[model samples]
Target: MTRIAINGFGRIGRSILRMLLTSRAEDGFELVAINDIAPLQSCAYLFAYDSVFGPYPGDVRHEDGAIIVDGRRIPFHSVADIREVDLQGVDVLLECTGAEGGRAEVERGLEAGAGSVLISGPSDVADMTVVLGANEADLGAHRVVSNASCTTNALAPLLALLDSHWGVESGHMTTVHCYTGSQPTVDKPKANLVRSRAAALSMVPTTTSAARLIGAVLPGLDGRIEARAVRVPSASVSCIDLTVQTRKPARVDEVNAVLEQAAESPVFGWITLPLVSTDLRMRSESIVMSGRETSVSVGGLLRVFGWYDNEWGFSNRMLDVAGLMAAR
Candidate 1:
């Protein structure tokens, strides 16, 4: 069995762990250890309401600097110094800390003898940044890989589709991203005063690196994309708005047809067709990719919408890439 070690127990990290436990039983991947500086009780409390696992129905006991989960007895390691943890037998190390300190963490994992390390957030030092189904083929053994943010994954297929079918001239995107843990629920005085306000009541402007990183996955799109972000009240699943200038002017129906075709392709089963506004209102929380319809102007511009469960959905894609690496 392939042993996997997960670093960080944040939202994305815990979601990835839950996903592996739920799906990897038949895939030969064993989640061996979870590492975080936070106390085991705190970690357990955070995941207490996990929809699938419900609550952690086990006691957390300390053993050899690791927290053991009762019954399952999975070790949750707490290492003050990440560099000292041994990962000699770990096949894959998933770093979901979303910290700028990713480079150091990844380096430590590689030095500990992990065969490969998959990062869930953006990092400047990874061997390559991968978007599952878009550029996963670029990953290989004994290398560090980073999965671009969920917004990037949500936009990649669309960009790839346009570039493949009708050449994309240029594009702009604005993501009304849902509030994340990084934002506060109530206004407070903080060092980073800009984001210190409550996200639930504000529409805060922010910067996004998705456009810059998306080009890495699709080289043909270099210097042709730009993005801006807004923090909204929603807790999960953010929305994306894209405007693209196609090589040739096309009707709304024609563009929608291309998206529908791409979504139906075996390669992009995650992309779903356009839905009516009423339909979306009915299943607002369903894990469907939004933006089935398109609005094409007389010019070559086309606008589209895309939605994703930033945490669960992106974690699913990350796991898919990690499993692929494990298979090799």
Candidate 2:
């Protein structure tokens, strides 16, 4: 089994642990150690009961310096610096901390004994950024890599598929995203005024890197796509509203048919039935396209709607990338 060490036991970190425990036999990955600033008891409690994912199905307890899940004890270290953790035999150190100085931390992980590093979010310093199906081949001999952002993971595959079948001219995406830890619960001071309001009370407009990063994955379409975000009150799940002008005209039926064939993969899903955010809670597909919501104009303009569990889907991709690295 591949030995993995988590650098941050936050939302993504805990989600990864849950996935490993639930599918350990099939996935062939092991949790060797976890490093977080929070105390072990706090981590254990949060893992046992999550607001979004609900209570973990397995028994969770903490003793000595490890969190025991289903009788398996994984070492837990509470530390501000990852260099202090013993990552001697770790195959990959998952960097989910969203640290601003992530480039430096990647080096620290390499020096601290980890064989490689996989960042949960985008990083300029990463050897490369991969969005699973869209750009998995781009992953090479690099030791440090990024899984990109959740929106990128959700949008890139769809765009790539569209562009492949009918060349894309230009596009714009607006992500109706759920509030995250970055925003405040109540009105407070923040660098971004729109995000300062209560997260559960307002739909705040902001910027996104997904549109910008698509070019990195599919260079032929770079400089042709733009994206923005609206932070909604929900705690999980996000929607992507994308409009693209294709070189070839397509009918609505044809577009939906293509997506339907692509469904059930780790990177994409096709939903024939109507559904809401809460219904998507633990659905593993990175992005699910609603066939009922697709529309295409005679003039080669196409609109697509997609939904994703921001944390769950992205966590799955992180592990998938880690496994890819291990296999190499």
Candidate 3:
């Protein structure tokens, strides 16, 4: 079995942990260890709040700093000193921490003899930044990989489609994303300049590194894309709006057909819904991929809209990519 370790226990980290607990048996992977700066006793409460495995999924218990699920006891430890733990047998170390701390976590995993370190969030030190199916092949020679942000992952397939079929001259994207744990529920001053404001009652304009990371995944798109982000009040789902300048103007149907084909492509197969929307009621939260695919559409002026459950959707893709890498 593939032994895995997780760092951090926040929204994405906790979701990744739950994903592993529920998916490992089927995927031939196992959660060997989990670390966070927070106390282990809080894990039970965190797990209870997780939408994926709310309030303990099946025969789960917390005892002696470990979580027992279906007779498997997964140990939890403090991340303050990651070197204290023996990760020699861990096949993959998932850094879902989303902190600048990720760089240190990857270093520790390498020192502990992990074959690969897969970061669930963006990181500056990763050997390569990937958006799963988009540039997964780039991970072949890398020991440490960073799965670009959820917004980037959700938009990659769509951008690839446009570039392949209509051909993109330049593009701009804005992700209306749900508020994360890092954001405050009420207005408060934070260390970061932009995120210091409250997320509950405001739309926070922020810059995104997704565009640069997207360029890494699709080298053909270098210097052709720009991105921005907005932190919204919703807790789970997020949406992306992209405006592209095509090399030559094409009919709306032609654009939709291209997206539909890319959605069916094995490499970019996550795009499930392709349509044109004139309804103002089309909401970011209402969009979801019921099947193993993504939703996409062509709006006026070569614009497109895509939606995703930032946490669940991206976490699912992370595991899928990890599975493929492990097999190789």
Identify the leading candidate in terms of TM-score. 2
Across residues 1-328, which tens digit of lDDT does each residue of candidate 1 receive? 7678888888877776655545444766778778898988777667655543355444544555554555355678777555567888888788877777746756888887788888887778898888865777777654788888878877776788777777889999998887877888899887767689998898888878786888898888988999889888766567778899988776766766766666654234324455432233212121344445457766668887766666766777766777787789
Q: List the candidate 3 regions with Cα displacement exceeding 4 Å.
A: 51-54, 102-105, 191-194, 265-300
List the candidate 2 regions with Cα displacement exceeding 4 Å: 23-25
Clashing pairs in 3: 270-293, 270-294, 271-294, 272-294
Taking all chains together, each candidate's TM-score versus the true structure is 0.85, 0.97, 0.84
> Superposing every Cα of model 3 onto the true structure, what RMSD results?
4.8
**Candidate structures ordered by lDDT, highest first:** 2, 1, 3
What TM-score number comes out for model 2?
0.97
What is candidate 1's CA lDDT for residue 320? 72
Q: What is the descending TM-score order?
A: 2, 1, 3
Winning model by lDDT:
2
- Runs of candidate 1 with Cα error greater than 4 angstroms are 23-25, 50-70, 102-104, 189-193, 264-288
Model 3, 54-151: lDDT tens per residue? Answer: 46476666787787666778898876766777888777777776767656656887787677888887888988887754677667767788888878
Clashing pairs in 2: none
Where does candidate 1 have its weakest 10-residue lDDT segment?
277-286
Candidate 2 residue lDDT tens string, 22-115: 7545788888899888888999999999999899997899997899988988888988888988788889889988886857867898888999
Error of 2 at 241 (Å): 0.8
